[model samples]
Target: MSRDLFRQAAKERQTLFNAWLMLNNPLALELAGEAGWDCVTLDQQHGAGGNETLLACLTAAKAAGLPAIVRVANNDPGLVGRALDAGAQGIMCPLINNVEEAEAFVRAVKYPPRGLRSWGPYRAKIGYSGDYFTEANDFTIACPQVETKGALDQLDEILSLEGVDMVCFGPNDLSVALTGRLDIWAKEVQEAMTEVLKKAREKSVMTLIFCNDADFAKPRIEEGWDIVAVGTDAGWLSSAAEATRAAVSPGS
Candidate 1:
């Protein structure tokens, strides 16, 4: 199948479940793929994932029949190109706070006439079939994150830009941007997020969000997010470990 599976799913109004791959362990990656996650985001922004590890994980994802998107640490063209070249079906750029940043993000993801991304897909081509050059534009997801008050300020213009298939919301920073804390459930945060969801829907732009668990994720899916990505594998492992330890600890 082509990478457009995710694209088609979004267009059909399906609420896709995306797992956040934080750990670089191949076993963990394979397990996540087998666990029935529709797709995954290789977290290079905050997690320990780097270029080499991301490449391996992408390859593993292909083997598992999973489509993947890489959340780059920053919105640099080189970072974007390398991730795509390494076979990430898409790229989720962070800190997209304006028209220029949004434009640049798309520019690096598409080919000429659409954008200026150079040609190179040695690693990506191994697993993909057909025309990588032409089809890549349509299949590859270009999700620019809508976080920060600055981004929210120009949300309309950013959302209206070409090549922006979806807008990923980062509630942690958005919560801080709206309120002065990291609470994703704050009234201001909800209002802003709801507004974004509404506007994005009206513009025919898909929406994705980052949440800590199913409790938070389910609501956003109900709120009409095209995709809702939940906790990282490492974070889940940590939480489960702590819970298990606390449950059997003498402090009970």
Candidate 2:
């Protein structure tokens, strides 16, 4: 479980409260950590900015004692390797379908012998502790998000992979993929997501759920998800502002 952040959280703490960061700002990242979140997952796919922002936030995460994770849009080796080199403790790539994709994604995060990732920890060495090269192979986490129907089809094989540390279920994308519409609460999507949890449990793998808010996340965490990155920094900020404005404005 130590090698798997989600599992570690599930075992030590019931479930990890993660801030899904859509903003590239370091201050926001620091505040999330200060808010007592177990970790932060920087959203590179739908989030703003690029590699530069990732490096900056990863540094901030280190100072805040919050382990940083990056959610890549696709399974690109360069992106995966770069995130690791920049000191991300975990890498969550979306739309990973089948064993080959899972295997390739894992290889990009792992080092020599175990994987093909080049030897480079420009920020990892400084942010992470004690001989990174030796410990990285075991310390880094590989979490592939199961979103599409294709991924759901190959869930078992993906879970059984040697390098997969955890499995993340993306309800937003899966909702559309499963029902041809965006409704995370749709019966079809819910059933598919439930199947993912069931299979992961059977394989002894940890699971994470990408949720929009606490209400959505609560059920998943209770249903066996180890961690839930509920809502992005942008969503939280905007929602708070709207709520405050509504309370101050005239209402009956």
Best by lDDT: 1
Residue 8 deviation, candidate 2, in Å?
A: 3.0
Kindly give the number of clashing pairs for every candidate. 0, 0
For candidate 1, write residues 1-252 as lDDT tens digits. 464767688778888888887786667878887888888888899878578888888888888887888999998999999999999878999988898899999999998889988999878777566788888887777899988888999999998998988899999998988889989999998898888999998888888899988789888877778888888898879998999999999979
* Candidate 2, poorest ten consecutive residues by summed lDDT: 1-10
Q: Residues 192-220, candidate 2: write the lDDT tens digits.
A: 88898888878877777889877888887
Regions more than 4 Å wrong, model 1:
1-3, 247-252
Please report how far candidate 2 places residue 142 from its true position, in Å. Answer: 0.9
- TM-score, per-candidate, Cα-based: 0.94, 0.93
Task: After superposing candidate 2 on the true structure, give the runs of residues whose Cα lies further than 4 Å from its correct spot.
Answer: 1-7, 250-252
